[model samples]
Target: MTASTLSAHHVGITVNDLEELLAFYRDVLGLTVVDRFAVGGDAFADAVGVEEGRAEFAHLEAGGIRIELVEYDPEARGSPAAGLNQPGATHVGLAVDDLEAFYADLPESVSTISEPRTTESGTSILFLRDPESNLIEVLES
Candidate 1:
């Protein structure tokens, strides 16, 4: 239960298009592609808690963290935008060695949301929203 004992494994987000999302994470953010998989038949069906009998997913690694991007078929189920940024919504905050360099390299759309400020706890950070409006925090180390 201590800080040293608590570890973050990965954060998963459902996206509408796998290729587009992969481009953003891979090219724009400079994350490395770690793994990818397409699942179908009974194994996928049971593992994902889905009745579609298939699944598609990719994994990206950046800043020592893993991001899992999932793309399910349109008719498979609900909407991806349904719970984004709601009151109880959760997003990942990543720490960077060079905050200024990271900010400078971001695209216009992503840069626009980089409102740099200091937290009450005295941590320097910049906040931005992804294409999906998921709040992302880049903290200065």
Candidate 2:
């Protein structure tokens, strides 16, 4: 039987620094912080596939899509080794009104993977990384 009625609720990202990540999403990206809370326990650990899990979480919303940021205890955290060609690597793409202006306003701390470039199809895209090195793409709509 085929499962139906499935939809994305939010994208969860495990972060090393909660405040820094929150500032990037909320202040820099203009997402609204919906809520913040702490979570831990055997149930959560099992669900996350961690032997023991504990974290501070925040929910931010942008253009109706929600992003859940989780900052696990230092001992529980793992190193990030995701590369562009890696199987499990993931990136979020956002549509912007002014790609050039937005690119110009980006903080100096952001490492740009690619400057804004336009394709033959008239779509402009910019690729960059967050402080934690999460890849992000901004496209002109």
**Cα displacement (Å) at residue 127, model 2:** 0.9
For candidate 1, what is the lDDT? 0.75
User: Runs in model 2 with CA error above 4 Å?
Assistant: 2-4, 74-80
Please, what is the whole-model Cα lDDT of each candidate in the order they appear? Answer: 0.75, 0.86
lDDT of 1 by residue, 1-141 (tens): 565776788899877778887887788777899999986887777787777656578998877889998887533554444243665666667788888788877888673454567779989898776675666778998
Residue runs of model 1 more than 4 Å from their true location after superposition: 1-8, 74-85, 111-114
Point to the candidate with the largest TM-score.
2
Q: Kindly state the number of residue pairs that clash in model 2.
A: 0
* Model 2: ten consecutive residues of lowest lDDT: 73-82
TM-score of 1: 0.77
**lDDT tens digits, residues 25-128, model 2?**
88888889999999789998888776787889999986878889989863454565668787788888888999999999988888888889998988999988
Error of 1 at 126 (Å): 1.7
Q: How high is the lDDT of residue 19 in model 2?
A: 96
